[model samples]
Target chain A: MKVRHSRILRTAGDMLLPLLLLFSLFLLLRGHDLPGGGFIAGLVASAALALYIFSRDMRSARQVLGTDPRSLLGVGLIIAILSGVPGLLAGDAFLTSEWYTVPLPGGREFTLGTPIIFDIGVYLVVIGAVMTIVLSLAEAEERPWKR
Target chain B: MSLAVILPILIPLSAGALSLALWRSHLAQRLLGVFGTGALLLAALWLLQRVWLDGIQVMYMGNWPAPFGIVLVADLLGAIMVLLAAITAFAVALYSLATLGAEHERFGYYPLLHMLLAGVCGAFLTGDIFNLYVWFEVMLVASFALLILGGERAQMEGAIKYVTLNLISSALFLSAIGLLYGLTGTLNMADLALKLQDTGEAEGLVTTIGLMFMIAFGIKAAAFPLFFWLPASYHTPPVAVSALFAGLLTKVGVYALFRVFTLIFTQDTAFTHELLLWLAAFTMLSGVLGAAAQFEFRRILSFHIVSQIGYMLLGLALYTPLALVGGVFYLMHHIIVKANLFLISGLVYRLRGSFQLKELGGLYRERPGLALLFLIPALSLAGLPPLSGFFAKFILVRAGLEAERYGVVAVALLVSLLTLYSMVKIWNEVFWKAAPEQGAAAVAPTNNALLYAPAIVLAALTVAIGIGAEPVYRLAEQAAAQLLDPQAYIAAVLGEAS
Candidate 1:
């Protein structure tokens, strides 16, 4: 009975984390127009992940993330830079945003492009870097004689 | 040929990544350390020649052309900063060889150090604002790792405050970039300069963004009210890491403020300049007072770093070519001298286990050579005559007077005297007084040649710059002129920004 209860709790947390992350990403993508942003959304996603780690364990969380957080941060930054590069390639200056459209299978589709990609990059950067820092600090604190 | 411009940044970055991948191998790490710094130093010298001959070397990455591509430009100022960074990184790498133990040596120190060097060099050389933010994060992340490498209690505590404060500053910097991008639709600094020049009626928005950038850089530079994180955190790391950070990181922030203000935001000078002047004065006084209050040797040096930053800001606030030149010259001198002093602190710790002034004394008798080495930079830091510090301050004060800012001149002079007093206090406490009875025996009488080598090299460089001030001063003057003119910089980066 106890094992079942623990498994249920774990499964619920697992479901909840991705939901929170997706919600945060939604907020970030819509940020420049509204009240959300890369920074705040990143913080929210990282916080949710932190909660997941607290409920589960760091090693398990690392497995889910599939890489070192620092590497993730580096990649996020590179992506952010690359997102800005399209603007430059289009003969605008650095960080000058360009918009475009794409078609979906169902019908004619319109979607915002470069700026959202940039925002996603920012979201990943802040989320990955902040989580790396917070998790490192937490683990350091958890050492046996840290007190 | 102008690709000499990008090589300084590229060499260190590629080397840093390679070091990280090969971190487990001692040979690979050391080879990266040597080759990375050596290549950077050579590139700096080569670029200096290019700047001397061709005026300024500009490289647009990926062959995308100006304003559109990420540009790296090497003016005299950028070249000098690159050189200084290379010199200091070289010295610190040497010191680390002796100071960092097996655990630390094995734990990615060289990679982080090289990465930091790359970040600093990138910050110095980049011609765009967003790139500056990226480099700031690069340096900050590397510094965070270096800070907490040993995981001591103090180090962890300091890291927490340092990271939190820096994270907030990076956020502010990013928001400022976002706002600037939203307003002007550009992040190329050269392009922004032209756009901002034509942005006459939007002066309010320009001022707002200017102030935001100032505050952001101010927090990073630790200029006055934002300086609390410095003293709270600087002394926590091992001496070699602290030395590198004290020498390089905050100066990168100061360099950014100098660059942006001189280039893109000169339109809002009245607000930014006056605000800077008062902050400079307050930062000077308060930093010295903090130094006065410190009983630990490294803590005192840390506080003085804050104080010296105030001096640099004074040059910026004065806003004349000569004054800015003085700030640049002072920055160069301070990087070498400050790093040397911190290395000396490491030497002192090697001889005597503690860094508290009360526990250290009469090093004149035991290690007079080290005492002499320490004294030159210490005296230079106090702005004594016939030293690089004095020349730096002389130009600054002269510039202040030329601008008819007598109050600033008075404050700067008084700060110099107070700086001398603090230096003397450290000198007397650490080297002049009788050695403590227990310390006398506990302190080994052995010579640490490996540790002393870097300090000696830096001291020699300090004296060389002091005695050979003509060429260096002229270089600074030219750099200052280029900064004030902004035409060549903009032309190089944005094809005249029409």
Candidate 2:
């Protein structure tokens, strides 16, 4: 019974983080048109991940993240760069964003496009960068030398 | 040919990765240094040629167009900085070969050094403000690692201070970028420049954004009150690493300040310009006075670095063509000379095993060549005649006089004399005094060619720049002109959209 109870709490913790991360993404994506965007969202997601790492072991969390934070940083940078390319393709100049419409299964086509992608790129960058610093610092602190 | 623009950043980044992955082998690390520095040098020289012969070079990665794509720019200013970075990186790499031992090499030093170089190059070439922030973080992370590479007590203490201060600066930088993006609705520097031009000089959101950006850059450049973190942290690292950090890192901040202030925030001259002038004067006086009070060789040199930064800031604060050119020239001279001096200190430490001036004396009688090596750069740093440092100061002081800013000129002259006094103090203490018996015995006369080679090469370049002042001065003048103009930069990036 105790094992099941602890298991339930573990699953609750795990589930809570991704949900919060998604909510942060929502805030980041809607930021330009609304209140939040890439940076704050990224920070939120990173904070959630930090909680997960604290509750769980770092090694397992690393497995879930699937790469070193440094590589994630590079990938984020590349995506950010790629997001800016569409505006360049339209000859709008570097990092220029353009809006477009994509059809959904419903009767209406929704407004979708590059600025959001750029935000997502920024999201990845901030999350990756902040995590890299935090994780390194945590690891450094964990060493026996501190005692 | 646009590939020329990306190569400088890419080569070092790849080499850095390779070094980290192959950390078990010292041979691989050494090879990484050779190939990385070589490729960077070749690329910088090629880019310089292209900039000189064919005008500004802009590369949009993966065939993207401007204003929408991330752009790598190689105008005269960017290209010259790239070249300067390449020169210092190469020399520092050579110096590190002798200064760093196997244990230090095993601690991921080479990889971090290359990443730091990549960050510096990327910061120099990037045309987007957000991209510049990313690169700044890259440089900062690598610097943090390098600072604490040995994990000694002193290293940890310094690293904590360095990381905290830089993290605050980075946060400010990010917040500024967010504010600017919110206000202007674009992150591209070129796009913002065009947008700002149409927006005209105003006292509202633009000024607020401008102030934020200036504070961010000012902190990074270690200007005035923002400079306290530098002297506290700089003396903790190994000499070669500190030399490279001293030479390139803050200059990257100054470079960003120069780029953004010239292109986007030109309208707010009254606020930014006057603030920079006062800050420059304070930074100069405080830095030199701090140096005058230091008894250690490295600590004194570190303080002098702050003081010299004032001259560079003075150029920008004055904001005339001559003054800007002087600022640019001063940056070039300061990087080479400052790096060389730090490397010489490394040599001194190697010979005497102590950096404190009071601990030992009388090196001139023992090692005349090293003494001369130290003397030349020290003199140049003091703004003595017929050296690159003098010409840089002359241009700045002349511009101050021409503008009839008599007070600034007077301060500049006073700072120069103090700089001379500080340099002479180092000379008198380290080279001229009689060798203490224990100190002289500790100094074994061993010739390490790799270490001295970089210093000698840097000193020779100092003379070369001094002799070939006409062309170099003209290059700086062109760069300064382009900075003041902004239309060309905006048009180049924005193209026909405007």
Query: Estimated TM-score per prediction?
Result: 0.81, 0.82
Superposing all C-alpha atoms, what RMSD in Å does each candidate have to the true structure? 6.5, 6.1
Each predicted complex: what DockQ?
Answer: 0.07, 0.08
lDDT of 1 by residue, B172-210 (tens): 999999999999998888888988997768889989989
Model 2 chain B: weakest 10-residue lDDT segment is: B437-446
- Interface quality of candidate 1 as DockQ: 0.07
Please write out the lDDT profile of model 1 over residues A39-71, one tens digit for every residue.
889888888888777667777778877776765
- What is the DockQ of the complex in model 2? 0.08
Which ranges of candidate 2 are over 4 A from the true structure?
A1-143, B200-202, B440-445, B496-498
What TM-score would chain B receive for each of the candidates shown? 0.97, 0.97
Regions of model 1 farther than 4 Å from truth = A1-147, B440-446, B496-498
| C-alpha lDDT score of every prediction, in listed order | 0.84, 0.84
lDDT digits (tens) for residues B57-138 of candidate 2 = 7777544666776778878899999999999999999888877888788667898999899999999999889999999998
Docking class of 2: incorrect
iRMSD values, candidates in order: 6.5, 6.6
